[model samples]
Target: MYVGQGGLIMTEVVGMVFIIIGIPFFLSGTIGLLRLPDIYTRLHALTKADNVGLGFVILGLAIQATSWLEVAKLFLIWFLVLVASATSCHLVADAALRRNIKPWTKE
Candidate 1:
């Protein structure tokens, strides 16, 4: 039960829904990171799924924000996370390539 904070029940519920939706994406990404055979595949899974997950979570948080500024800040945080993850993933893949790490094969 929402107490105080103007009791915005609808927004709160919607925000929780978004958060719940995002959890699975995060979980799947983590599972992929652990189960994938190669660095490239793991990186692919981590960045793609986790980014989407974070986006959904951020959207949910933004929906529940009390003010425009809070929403903007949330968006900014998501953007920064997106940039950081992408840059780190690229760097890691490049390093792996430089080290001659081969991709996993079925055989």
Candidate 2:
């Protein structure tokens, strides 16, 4: 059997691990959205989860890729995800701040 033949099993395991790790982050973000007292805090959770989830997913993909071309594609995907997520998060936060959405207090 070829390395690529066993690669499928390895890829499946890695993908599953990434998904499992990402689930907690995603769920935490959802919970924060529901439980957080304000928009800023909710945005924090959202951005954190988005970054973490993308990181894990990209790591899994990188592990699975065998060729230089495949790895380059994964790198591009990771870069795109990072840029998009950060830009979106910044935009949302900026919009909220501009609109004067108050942050939560510990009191």
Candidate 3:
């Protein structure tokens, strides 16, 4: 949607750029999960997506957001995901350790 009658706004263009930049972070994270050798490593990649990738996405969305309330909600959701991803990653790693899952190593 055009924010102005003349043309697209700078913020919208910047926000779209941010969104485009964010996609790779997400794809890499997904690729990491499928291709990584171990649980910890996979968790690392996924959390990168949840943290950095999602941040870019949320930021872009927030920038393009029409209302302040929407921005607030975006940030709130980002914060919650951050907390949850971190906690879950830690717990999964801890459980893996308890189960004696060895990190993959190359000789």
Q: Each model's RMSD to truth, in Å?
A: 2.1, 3.2, 1.8
Q: How much lDDT does each candidate structure score? A: 0.94, 0.78, 0.89
Which residue segments of model 2 deviate by more than 4 Å?
1-16
Residue 19 deviation, candidate 1, in Å? 0.7
**Mind giving the per-residue lDDT tens digits that candidate 3 earns over 1-107?**
54464344877888998888899998999999899988889998999774898899999999889899999999999999999999999999999999999898987
Which residue runs does candidate 1 get wrong by more than 4 Å? 2-7
In candidate 2 the C-alpha lDDT for residue 21 amounts to: 78
Q: TM-score of each candidate?
A: 0.90, 0.72, 0.90
Query: Considering summed lDDT, which 10 consecutive residues are worst modelled in model 1?
Result: 1-10
Rank by lDDT (best first)? 1, 3, 2
Instruction: Judging by lDDT, tell me the better candidate of 1 and 3.
Output: 1
lDDT of 1 at 27: 98
lDDT of 1 at 16: 91
Count of residue pairs whose backbone atoms collide, per candidate: 0, 0, 0
